[model samples]
Target: MLSQKAKYALQALLALAELDEGDSLMIGDIAEKQRLPKRFLEQILLDLKHQGVVQSWRGKNGGYALLKSADKITFGEIVRIIDGPLAPLPCLSRMAYRKCDDCVDEERCAVRRVFASVHDATTEILDSMTLTRALNGGEVRELLRGTG
Candidate 1:
């Protein structure tokens, strides 16, 4: 399930993605435009900045912008930044893998096998869905339909 924070972060990024080259939006403006809580957005943007997804400037005309192109930023990367691993089980996580305490044989575990396929499919789609693809109405619909 997508966390509220991750949802808001994606909303905010989509807003940023709409900006013209070299332009930026203030945090309050982003929150207002996206209908997000200003305080929560501030924290989310800060985390994204630290993760190098965004860059900020401080001045009368300063604001925030994507550090890279929209097509270069994938949904999987953003979700991982905001929500951590996409795996259903700790053992299935690539970045944060851990052995399940009760597991007797990981390779033979039916639950693990099923969820590993789930994780792989999920990550495959997500990693391929970039912000540019998301911003396109047709692409978004196709992706949701599992036909992209």
Candidate 2:
């Protein structure tokens, strides 16, 4: 499940994605435009900025903007940034892998095997679904078809 913070972050990013090149939007404007809480958005933007996903400008016209092209940013990247690993189990996480306490043999664990497939499929679609593809409709469906 997507956390509220992650959802808001994506919404804010999408709002920024709509801007013309070299243009930026203030935090308040982004929050208002996306109907997000201003205070929470402030922190979210800061986190994103730290992750190099966005850059902040200072001054009268200063705001936030994507550090790279939208097509270079994937949902999986942003989600992992804001929400950590997407794996259903710690053992399945590549970045934060840990042995499950109850597991006797991971290779033979039925639950792990089933969820590994789920994790693989989920990550495949997410890693492929870039912000540009998301903004352009039908790309997700096409990605889904390709994955299957």
Candidate 3:
């Protein structure tokens, strides 16, 4: 599952995508359209601005818009920004790897091997899917690992 942060980010991005040229959405507007709370949407948009996924203009018409075209930005990248890591195990993670304590051998663990493949496959699909594609209701499956 996407974290609350990631879900909100996706929602906000979709809302921004709905705007016309040079048109920006206010926090309240995005929250209302996305059914998110204003305070939470504000923080999420701020973080997205920091990440350069979106930008904000400071004024009455100010809110946020994509720094780049939506199609150029992949879902995997956005998820990494908000969710930290997509991999189920830290050891299998590319961006956020940390050693697992219970594994007797990092190089030879069957559990790690299976999940590592899953992570790679998931990333492959997500890396190809863009924010616009998702906003358009693209048919990407949620590649959530574990926690059945």
Best of the candidates, TM-score: 2
lDDT of each residue in 3-53, candidate 1, tens digit only: 999999999999999999999999999999999999999999999999999
lDDT string for model 2 (1-148, tens) is 9999999999999888888999999999998899999999999999999999999999999999999999889899999999999999999999999999999999999999999999998998889988887887636567878852
What TM-score would every model get versus the actual structure?
0.92, 0.95, 0.87
RMSD of each: 2.0, 1.5, 4.7
Q: TM-score of the candidate numbered 3?
A: 0.87
Listed per model in order, the count of residue pairs whose N, CA or C atoms clash below 3 Å is 0, 0, 0
Residue by residue across 1-148, what tens digits does model 3's lDDT show? 7788888888788788767768888888889988998998888888888998898887876777888888788878888888888998989876667899887899889999898888888887788777777767666554243211
Residue 78's lDDT in candidate 1:
95
- Whichever of 1 and 3 has more lDDT, that candidate is 1
CA displacement after TM-score superposition, residue 84 of candidate 2 (Å): 0.4
lDDT computed for candidate 2: 0.92
Q: Which residue pairs overlap in candidate 3's backbone?
A: none
